[model samples]
Target: MKVLGSGQYRFERVESWPNVPKYFEMGQPSDVAINSSGEIFVLSRGKHPVTIWTPEGDFIGSWGDGMFSATPHGIFIGKNDNVWIVDCGAHVAMEFAPHGELLRTLGNKNSASPTCEGRLVHAQPFNLPTNLAIAPNGDIFVADGYGGHKVHRFNSKGELLLSWGRQGREPGQFELVHNVWIDSRNRVLVCDDENDRVQLFDTEGKYLEEWTLGNPSGICIRDDIVYFAQLQPFEDKSNGRGSGSISLYNLDGVLLSSWDNTAGGNKDTLIGPHDLCVAENGDIYVCEVYGWRVSKFRKIQ
Candidate 1:
């Protein structure tokens, strides 16, 4: 198997992982989240909307066939192993029980929030809530990305409590607010994707600070470190053929370790890594958009 990264962040790519069911056709896998049992939950826009796999990448089961939209987006696993998903096409955020039942939904489905054509994104609900993050107290924070340049906060009961963000190059603004993560400090860390930065904020929508991370698409917080996937390097941002990589940083935003499978190297390349999950054993799972594959990177530290 080909290897990627070095030092403490080293990982060996398994040649074949995640075998889908028979007659399955996937254009591209969207995102992934690991449950408390270490089982991987993958979100897709394909025939199988959600699939479960063992830690070794063995296919276990599948669900949510006709229940999702044409374009499935981010997913997050919360307490009691409940699954939270966002459908960019349907323009709604939902929470589902682990048993594949829909527990709750936010925003009106199949409805599009208004936005100008020339804008990169706008500040409004239902425009395109890309992903979500849940606080320790069970509040939901969503990154209204793609067509909407805002973040929405909701109570556990699905009430829209607060929302902030706008399309701009300024601190509180966003170009493509891609993903959201609630760190151990209970702060909201947003991946301002197109702006090449990660903006930080208090739980109550107060601006704190921001860090320059090139074309970040997703963020994962395990232990006290923050792990984020960059869709492409800063210089390659506009090209669309991004050399994707994942980077680890301290909660203070200090760089620690990074694995670049892009660049000129082809060993276990991670192209357009949209979302990632870290297992309790440190194994890293990455889902790519154009690559149409979910690759596993076993930790060797």
Candidate 2:
């Protein structure tokens, strides 16, 4: 799966977890989250279950076998150590205990309509939820991506507070609201991915401002820095050998350092890097779609 690009970036491939089930081998790795214990959780597309691995690349465990029908999009590890898995296939969000226990699942498991008050009624009828963010008050925010293009907020008990956003390319409008994260100020940052930018808003969905990132997919905010996994342009006919790059930006959307994927060569160069997570120790874990592997990068300086 090595791919070479005209740019200075090269992609390399890395073997993952030795041998796992055949079903886990392929699909796009959509979102990644690292827990307080340094465990990496990846929401992959090929299989309905989410895979968990140690920071050292050891297979820790896996769960959510048949819970999703389409694709598991976004994932996050809360401050309380609970794992939140967002299933775009099921059009719902689920919470699991640290040890893989099912704490609570949100959304109607068997609804067929797209307009449910508190949760998703029909799986494909509603907006596809991409990623999730937890507020300081324990409120959960789900970025409804493909279907309806809205951000749904819920209380700890799964009660709907409010939902906003519609389909458009304008500043307040969201063409593809891919991911969301809460900063230290409790402001919500939505990765308006398709718009080629990241838009900042308050918890109430008020439009603040946005900054470009070429083709951004996933984002994580740590301290005063925000890390973005920017995918290659889709229109390029390079036989999927496009080189993805990671960009570091500040809270005000100022560009810092940019890392070309050449660290792994062509195959290891990130292809369709959808999600990323930063460990407490400043290590970064990136999940890729075409490569089907998670790579870790550490800060040298």
Candidate 3:
């Protein structure tokens, strides 16, 4: 079996671990998350949209048809098994039950902030909202997405408390705030895509620090390790196959290791790693945007 990563982070690739129902096709899997009971929840742009599966590759169920927007973006299974999803085309991040019951909605429906202005006008909760992160207290943090240059924080009851970030090449500013994740210390981590960096901040939206990395598209923090997926390759000569790579970091933001190969955009091992998450048992699941598939990597300690 093919393997990626080294030493403590080593993982054996598991090909075709998930078996969706017959004719269960999707355009591109946006994001994937595993719940406590080992069930996998996938966000896709398929006919059925949201689907669930058992650990043994059996199709358990699927739901959320004709409900989401034109495009499905991200999924994060959070506290109490609440399923959180983002619809960039519709510009909203909503909470839902496992059976596709709508619980709460964060952003305004079908509303968006003007993006081409090349700067942030103000804090508008709507406009291509991408991903979601839940704090220990149930407060939600949203990445206002490439369409809006800001990060939004809302109280548990869906009240907008604060919004921060702007458009600029300066340290505190952001070009495309793609995703957000709250770490063990409750520190907010934002994947600033177009800027090619990850900016750290306090829950109050205060800039803390930033780290230069390849076009980071998604972020997942588990235990003491931080895992981020690289955006798809576009440039003719990308540095170190800049796209389709997964890099690991420590809680202190120190570079630990990276999983990429060869050169000259040689990508057969890992392609278009849009979103990913490490399971409790150390397995890794990746959702892709260009490759139109999801990958599973088993930890081989």
Best by TM-score: 3
TM-score of 2: 0.84
lDDT by residue (tens digit), candidate 3, 151-243: 888888988888887777687688888898999888999999889999999998778999898789989988868999888674345443324
Candidate 2: count the clashes.
16
TM-score of candidate 3 versus the correct structure, residues matched by position: 0.92
Residue 99 error, candidate 3, Å:
0.9
lDDT by residue for model 2 over 218-256, one digit each (tens)? 889877678889876543456755567788777777777
Indicate the worst ten consecutive residues by lDDT in candidate 2: 3-12
Off by over 4 Å in 2: 1-27, 110-126, 235-238, 262-268
What is the C-alpha lDDT profile of model 1 across 127-207, one tens digit per residue?
777899899999999988877788889888887888887778898888898999998888999999989999999988889
> Candidate 3, 221: how far from true, in Å?
0.7
Error of 3 at 180 (Å): 0.5
Q: For candidate 1, give the lDDT of residue 272.
A: 73
Please give each candidate's TM-score.
0.91, 0.84, 0.92
Highest lDDT: give the candidate number: 1
- Per-prediction CA RMSD (Å): 3.1, 5.0, 3.0
Candidates 1 and 2 compared by lDDT, better number: 1
